[model samples]
Target: MATEGIEAVFLTTHNWGKAAKFFQALGYELDFETDHNSGQLRNGDGPYVFISEIPEDQETQTQIVLKVPDADAFRADSPVEVVTPFEDTHYGTKEMTVRDPDGRLWNLQAPGKN
Candidate 1:
């Protein structure tokens, strides 16, 4: 299972307001917002980016969204230490991640490309 050029969305900003405006200027529309200071920005079709503010309790974190063909299968087969198990996301995708050797997490997102 493999993703067909999945858009690797990332959270690079600490301010959601500024980030939203910037992406909007760049043509990305604000689709939805998550409770945990996270939100999604969609451009056209695929590769919608997800942005989340740094939690006050948790230090700033950055995530790399990797496209997996079959998120469920990939999660079951992955060798890395799983942080968040693959499950149905609010934006309609199966996502999972593992903290890398350096503690950085790689977010694997597999939207239903069907």
Candidate 2:
């Protein structure tokens, strides 16, 4: 199956407060926040924006979430390196993570799996 579209943009930031403010100023409604360290924001439609604090000793990076029809099939046919195998998330979706040649992370998600 092919990717339906972008589901979300996961951002790793040094300052979660600053990042949250930035997205909020852009009219992204706050969906939820966790321990003041991470949050999910969305406009009206389309993909969401997820901001989180960078892990210690890890360089900040951005991740894109792609909505797919089937996470398992996508992983099986994908040519990229699989960083994480298909699994169910607490948020009710099946997801798999892959890394590009440049080491960029891409999360593939399929709805109603979990």
The number of the candidate with the highest TM-score is: 2
- Weakest 10 consecutive residues of candidate 1 by summed lDDT: 55-64
Please identify model 2 stretches exceeding 4 Å from their true place: 55-57, 72-83, 99-104, 112-114
- Give candidate 1 misplaced runs (Cα > 4 Å): 55-61, 75-92, 98-105, 111-114
Tell me how many residue pairs clash in candidate 1: 2
Distance (Å) between predicted and true CA of 104, model 2?
4.4
Candidate 1 similarity to native, TM-score: 0.60
* Error in Å for residue 36 of model 2: 4.9
lDDT of 2 by residue, 27-67 (tens): 99899999859999999998999998986688998878999
Q: Estimated TM-score per prediction?
A: 0.60, 0.79
What is the lDDT of every predicted structure here? 0.75, 0.85
- What TM-score does prediction 2 earn? 0.79
Which whole-number lDDT from 0 to 100 does residue 94 have in model 2? 86
